[model samples]
Target: MGSAVLDIGGNTGALVVVTGPEWSGREIEISTKDQDPLARTRAAVRARHTGAGTRYTAVFPTLPAGPYVIWRTATEPAGTVVVAGASVTEIEWWQLP
Candidate 1:
């Protein structure tokens, strides 16, 4: 699971990603709010291995207000997070059989 905050101050927020008990230290990516030409060419926001078991945290220190996509790789299963001003949006990922 992961989260991002929406604020007008351009402050960074924390995102916690949880794959499962079997997976740890997985590299995950996040997208910025709204659509920008630079957004596609820009690097995907990456989550770091928290070293806290199966949890990864990605922090955007200067994130603009909008919705962001939190995913493992592709946009599918892309958890949509809406920031309404300094609020934490918790998102989770899963694998289906």
Candidate 2:
């Protein structure tokens, strides 16, 4: 499971990937555009319970500002997002292409 706590500011930010139950327990990988595709970071999908309902998410608590590629597999990228400093970026897993 991933940590819900986030500390973002300045040249740092965070990413939240909302996923489905099928993704639970899976580790999602991401890499900055400037880095080699083989260089990646991983976060585990966890269930979050809220007043509205339960949500499955993978949280990248801290990351540098840049274009990041979210990988669907070792050789496939699901999508990309430009992360800005001092912000929390959220994306739905199913919306990736």
> Per-residue alpha-carbon lDDT of model 1 for 53-93, expressed as tens digits?
43444344344556676654455535566544454444555
Give per-residue lDDT, candidate 1, residue 24. Answer: 44
Worst 10 residues of 2 by lDDT: 1-10
* TM of each candidate vs. truth: 0.46, 0.94
RMSD of each: 6.4, 1.4
Misplaced by over 4 Å in model 2 are 1-3
Q: In model 2, state the lDDT of residue 33.
A: 91
Number of the top-ranking candidate, with lDDT as the measure: 2
Model 1 gets an lDDT of 0.47
Candidate 1 lDDT at 44 equals 28
Model 2, residue pairs in steric clash: none
Model 2 / residue 86 / CA error / Å: 0.4
- lDDT of all the models against the reference? 0.47, 0.92
Query: Per-residue lDDT for 79 in model 1?
Result: 57
TM-score of 2: 0.94
